[model samples]
Target: MMNFTNQISTATDPAKIVDELAQGKAEDYNIGFLFVSGLSNTAMAEVIALLRKRLKVDHLLGCTCAGIIGSEAEIERLPASTLILGKLPGVKILPFSLNQTQFDDFQQVDDWLQFFNVFPNENPKFLILPDPFLFDMHEFLSGLNQVYPGCPVIGGLASGAMQPRENLLFINNESFEEGIVGVALVGNFSVSTIVSQGCRPIGQSYIVTRAENNIIYTLAGRPFIQVLEEVLQKATARDRLLAQEAIFLGIAMDEYTHNFKRGDFLIRTVIALDQSTGAGVITDYAKAGQTVQFHVRDAETATEDLNELLLSHRKKEQNKKPLGALVFSCNGRGENLFREKNHDISIIQKCVGPVPAAGFFCAGEIGPVGGSNFLHGFTNSIALFYPEEETAA
Candidate 1:
């Protein structure tokens, strides 16, 4: 059987926070995740020590963030901490940490297997937290894809720090301000991932006819800017107004997919446009023959996108309700973008039936889209955990 408990405390003192978290009936939790926000390094360390002594969990992993999410609410820019303890029977929890040097040294599939002491056949799913300033997340994710092939990798970049060594990562009794800390879960558990980029298509999809790297010269044999203007002319008043500052480009992940729609393409920010050359530059690369579309984002679109994805997940997994979830939402979200507190976590609980959930607002969220994991911004990435047998049902 699998069980999870989630708790949150807003007490200013570390001992008070730990005391509040330790109030519930103690279970033999095999794994625990702790997310802290607005806490000093000294206080965070003390809280970790107290939790270790109080909970006595064998495996513990987590990090600091700008905001913390719990089962009931989300606290942003406040001195808060949330803990999630799980009793996962028949699950193999392998916790590991990688320094910058070790991360750079890994070059092959065997290197990863040897370092993690696990095989690809184990079908492990990963939950990772890496310091944004110190690690090359793109390279690390690419290596995991090459090594694990279709395995799901979920989590986020540690936030709430302006520089390196400011954000803390926790693994068991140790903590670090740099590098990456994560765990690999193998056996008797299943994870379903949802990655909502929080943008809706604004114009008809068009094929890229000319492009170089991240710059697009033409779409459907017309200047990219011209196509963009035409799309804007045809858009609604609200959409046109949003396109001024909220415009983005979506690149279809699968070329073979004929009809592209919402969630079909990878959303990337439109960084700049060269009107003189009638070209546009996006955050990601574009190539000829690729499908592209203009997208716009706002509070309404973000809420709708998240709701649609969550409802779809619930419908698909009707037989096996998730027991818990780990959410990684972009720091750009929360009350800043939604104009209200607890928007993401509240919607999650409403859709997922209030399952034990915990996470933090991340610098960048990580999850799979189109069978490939990519780092995303202005997004919400979630990992839903359930029994393995339920996955087969």
Candidate 2:
């Protein structure tokens, strides 16, 4: 059996917050996660020590963030902390941490396997927390994808720090400011991921005919700028207005899948465009023969995107309901983008039925899209835990 519980406290004092979190039926939680907001490094350390001593969790992984998301509320820019405790009867939890220097030393799949002390055949799922300033997110994610193919990596970049070493990452009883901390769950569990990029596809899809690295020179043999202008001219008045600052590019993740639609493309931000040359630069690499489309984002689109994905997950997992969830929402979201509080979490509970969930506003959210993991922004990366049934001998 798998059991999970989540608790949140907004008290200013660390001891009181810990006390509030500890007020519940006692169970030996084998793994735990903590997300803290508006707490100093010293105070967060105290909370970690207290939780470890009180809960006796065997493996704990967490980080500090600009906001904390609990089961019932989303607390932003306040002194808040949320903890998730889980008891799994048949699971192996392995915790590990790596610094920039150690990560740079890793060159092969064997290095990653040795570092985690697990084999690729084990098929473990990872929850990682890395300081946004010091960690090379692209390199780390790419390595994990190569090493553990099809394994889900879910978590977020630590937030609420103005510079390097300001954000805190916790593993077991210790905390650090300049490395990545994570845990590998190896057995008797399943994780379902929902990555909502919060953008609506606009304009027709076009094949990339000319591109170099992250720059798109042509689409369907026409200059990229000309295609974008034609799309805008054909778009609705509201969509054209939104394209001014909210435009993005979505690349089809699977080239073989035909009739692509929403949820079929991996969205990337359009950073700049060369008006004279009709070229555009996006955040991710683009190559010739990839399918591409323009996208737009707004409060309505974000809400719709998240709701649709959650509903789809609910429909797919009708037989085995999730026991718990960890939500890594982009810091750019929340009330700032939604114009209302508790937008994402509320929608989730409404659709998924209030399973124990805890996480934080992240600098960047991490999850898999189309079988490959990538770091994303203005996105909500969620991991839902489900218990696997026993197989016959």
RMSD of each: 1.6, 2.1
lDDT of each: 0.88, 0.89
Query: What residue pairs clash in candidate 1, if any at all?
Result: none
Off by over 4 Å in 1: 389-393
Residue 305 CA displacement from its true place in model 2, Å = 1.0
Residues 354-378 of candidate 2 have per-residue lDDT tens digits of 6899999999999998888999999
TM-score, per-candidate, Cα-based? 0.96, 0.97
| Lowest lDDT 10-residue stretch of candidate 2 | 384-393
Runs in model 2 lying further than 4 Å from the true structure: 389-393
lDDT at 5, model 1: 88
Each candidate's clash count = 0, 0
lDDT of 1 by residue, 1-393 (tens): 898889999997988999998887377888899999998888889999988888868798889889999988988988899898888899988999998888878877788999988787888898999889878888888888888877889999999698989999989988999989999988878899989999988778899999999999999999999999999999999999999976999888887888776678889998999989899999877899998889999999999999999888888887457888999999999999999989998899888866999999999989888777788999999999987745521
Q: After superposition, how far is residue 22 of candidate 1 from its true place, in Å?
A: 1.7
Which is the leading candidate under TM-score?
2
